[model samples]
Target: MPLNEEEAVLLGAAWQRLAGGGPEAAAVGAELLDRWNEPHRRYHTLLHLWETLRAVDVLQGEAADADGVRYAVWFHDAVYEGRPGRDEEESAELAARLLELVGEEPARIGEVVRLVGVTATHRPEEWDADGKVVSDADLSVLAGPTDEYLAYTAAIRAEYRHIPDRVFRAGRSRVLRSLLDGPHVFHTAFGRAHWEARARVNMLAELDRLASSAPLDLPPP
Candidate 1:
């Protein structure tokens, strides 16, 4: 869904803050909107961005660098082209350049870039409280109700329409298995308490469905 008026206002405010509250902020915000609103996007559209920013707001109390986390959330998927590590690498680099253009301090820009890159692994260092906060928020969707989780999976499938079904399912199952095998799917205490159990339940159910599906045929060697 497109953002409501209030959410749009809040997004503008965030951009203004990050871009040093100059006239250039509007231009930067428009550019971001264009990128995220690209027609080919399904799940990583503005709806996801707004949801993530809302999550950041709800969890900022736990962040060591709340502004950095917010900026990271906006830029993390900014360059998403369905290429995992490359998407993150490009997003982080673009975020650093944009923040620098806004005359942000080098340290602050570095922190934002670092936070954006951390989403690639979704594993933050022990001392990276801000990273933990953003990571948990970014993954908060996994904890949603079953219907929403189903919808999310469907949206993801839509995003990767180019991939054949068998290939996509196998790749998706592997990703789910990785999440299931993790010590904790969510890093923060709040995320652990609120999202961990539900995410596991959702993942396990999806994993079972995936496993039960017939395997793709292979040609004789």
Candidate 2:
């Protein structure tokens, strides 16, 4: 489903706050909402966009260019197709094109594109405050409560339902293990203090379940 009226109003306000209120900004925001509401998306839907934006708000003070990070959040998964690197790249491209149409400053647009690309790896240099904020916000879903985390995984699996069970399981395991191997699953101090441990627990639990299960037989959402 698309964002509800209140949610749409909030998102429009956010876009206008960054890009300014005008016909171009309105059109760009509407197009992005449509992209988020694309039928093929499962986990990477409007809900994820809203959650990531909220997380950015929580970590806003940590960013040198919080508006840039918010712009990145609006485009990070805008082109998600279950393909990792390519998706981020295309999303960044789309951000650049649309942001230009709305007359966003070139430097800010470049920063937004770079921030969107950071989500592909979820790794930013320790000194990159804006990048760190964007990465943390995009990954906050990993630290969700148990039921929400499981629902996230289910939605993800549903998104990639075309992949064979064994293939998907192996890929998902690698992704989880990489996160677990990191010193901290989240980049910001708030994330480390509040979300890191819970994210680890959630990922570890999912890893264990994936290890023991033959295949996830999830119903359509």
Candidate 3:
């Protein structure tokens, strides 16, 4: 879906802040927005980008380089294709190229690339403030209200509609199990305090549903 006027304004302001307000920067932002709106996407759409950005704003003070975190958020899923590791690697590469196009410093571009890579595992070192913030913000959807969380899972199912229900359930259940087995679902202190428990509850409930005999009420592909 095309960005609404409010989303456009907000994203434009954010792009200006991070990329220093140039035509090249604007072009790059437009390109990323286009990718986010691609028809193949269901969950990883512009709406997800907007939500991540908003979550970042809530945890901005926790970032060592807040602008870098924002840049990472913009590019983290810029090339999502349902392939987790390769998608992140390509997205990091995309971030590097576009940030360089907009005359971002080499070091800053490198940081953005690294931050984008961190999203692959969501397992940044405890001392990595920017990584923690980016990971937590990207995952904030997991902690949303019950209805919103169900919608998120349904959208995810839609995205992988090519996979059979049994296969998708097994794979998704494994992913959820790994997350639940982790020390914390969210990395940052704010996330741990505010989002961790709810995210766990949501994931556990989804795991139950996935394991049950009843079919999911997911949107048709």
Candidate 4:
């Protein structure tokens, strides 16, 4: 699908936030692709960004934001690894810098930063708009059908490069099971109403595959 108007504004805002405005398409496109190329970071790649941006659109449905959700997307996985607080801290820092450069209100920028943190690890009992949406966007991939989900898993495995397959499998199975057995894969009505069944089904199939140990049947790494 083509970039929707709200998505465009959000993209423009991220570009403006990042480079202080008036950035050419080539530059931003290159930056987006560059970020995509970082090995093993594929789960949070530009495609994921594009997909989540679209998912958020599906959720919000043509609303423009005084929101920092756009900004949150840009920084949500900014530091997925190595930096424990990168998503929150760097996202906040980027928001602050963007606000300073783009002339947004300092107070709004702070809230945007706070919103980003709220999304870090969603806690159901403590839900808010940003937290809910951010969490939904991040989990949207699970809602995808088979091939895409496998591709996502491969990308995630790539991210943890040093870990051996045996070790990785053990860890991967645990996480997959956690999602499969969870109460809900997505929190919001829009997503739950739409993507939940598909996600759970896919997750269970993958889990079953992981639980098997027939030497002749297990696929090669």
Candidate 5:
């Protein structure tokens, strides 16, 4: 179903707020593309946003508030300057303005903005189901089929193009290892059941490529 009027309004308001901040987030999909994804030529920019929303739709209660989800989408990558702290604060500030425009009750809007800040953590230890669902959606790209996974590897690498091959490889390997070594590849049953195993397979394949210095094909192993 197309997003209803309410959702469309809220989403547009949220996006407007993001654009007003002067980064032109919608132009090429937030800083995730320019600073990281573009630098690394990673495919996680708009495509990631699109797929995550699709996942959210299939999930029950997963939409929470389309506005809330929209807020998360804008702010999730808000903090991608290859540095930390700033993204969350900047996103929170933008959210504050958007909340004002949305005519959200001052208190509730503040709370929603804060939740957007929460996403800076990417994976919270404990949280509301809505936040978790959205977060899982953001990370779900990692859990896709092998070919999709390899594409992500390139995206991430493009983001870090300034780093030498050795440094980037080591760091990237560590990230993949951490995910692979984790007790759960995904936080929610939906993502775990649906995408975790394949994610692992793809991650391991990337790891192997790093270790062997071999050209990786789509989907690694």
Candidate 6:
């Protein structure tokens, strides 16, 4: 799908902020908008990118490199081919290439690229404050109110529509369990204060729902 009006506006704004108004930055934004508008996308669409950037802006005070975080937020899902780590890797590579084209400093471009891939695990070295900020912002949706969270779940299910229900539930349950088992779902202190409790509640509720569903062995059609 082509980028919608609101999405195009958001992309333009992000590019203007990052690129400081130029054709090269506009081209980079267009490339990212194309990926976010890909027909197969659901939850990882421009809406997600827009919301994530908003969240980052809200948390910018805590970031060691707000610029890098913003750049990463724009391109983190730029190559969502449905493979987890591979998708992040490819997105990071794209970020590097595009940032270089726009004449971003080598160090800043490296940081942006690293941040894009860092999302694959949502974990960073203890000293990586920027990584924590981006990770927490990316996952802020999990802690959103019930209605919004439900919508996010629906969108994600639609994105993976090809997967069988039973298989999807099992895989999703595992992902939720991993987060629940972790010491912290949102690494930053502000994130913990704002989202940790609610995220846990939501994840546990969803996991319970999955557990109660009937088992099936049929393959995806």
Q: Which tens-of-lDDT digit does each residue in 59-126 have in candidate 4?
A: 66422352466656665665456344565577566556655555657776776677667555544344
How are the candidates ranked when ordered by lDDT, highest leading?
Answer: 3, 2, 6, 1, 4, 5
lDDT of 1: 0.84
Give every collision pair in model 4: none
Computed on alpha carbons, the lDDT of every model, listed in order, comes to: 0.84, 0.91, 0.92, 0.63, 0.60, 0.84
TM-score ranking of the models: 3, 2, 6, 1, 4, 5
TM-score list, all predictions:
0.92, 0.96, 0.96, 0.72, 0.69, 0.92
Please tell me which model should have the higher TM-score, number 3 or number 5.
3
Worst 10 residues of 2 by lDDT: 212-221
| Ten-residue stretch with the least lDDT total in model 4 | 212-221
Report the number of clashing residue pairs per model.
Answer: 0, 0, 0, 0, 10, 0
Off by over 4 Å in 5: 1-44, 60-66, 215-221
lDDT of 3 by residue, 11-126 (tens): 77877877877789889988998898899999999889988999999999999999899999999999999998999999999998998999989999999999999999898998
**lDDT of prediction 6:** 0.84
Candidate 1: which pairs clash? none
Candidate 4 stretches with Cα past 4 Å from truth are: 1-40, 61-66, 82-89, 124-127, 180-182, 213-221
TM-score (C-alpha) between model 5 and the true structure = 0.69
Q: Write the per-residue lDDT of candidate 6 for residues 1-221, one digit (tens) a residue.
A: 23478876766787788777778877777777787888778789888888898899889998998988999998899899778899999999998898998899999999998899789998877899999999999999999898788777877777777888988998889888887888899988899998999999998888877788654322232
lDDT of 5 by residue, 73-140 (tens): 65555445454458667767766765565455676566667666655555645556666676677777
What's the lDDT for residue 146 in model 5? 66
TM-score winner between candidates 2 and 4: 2
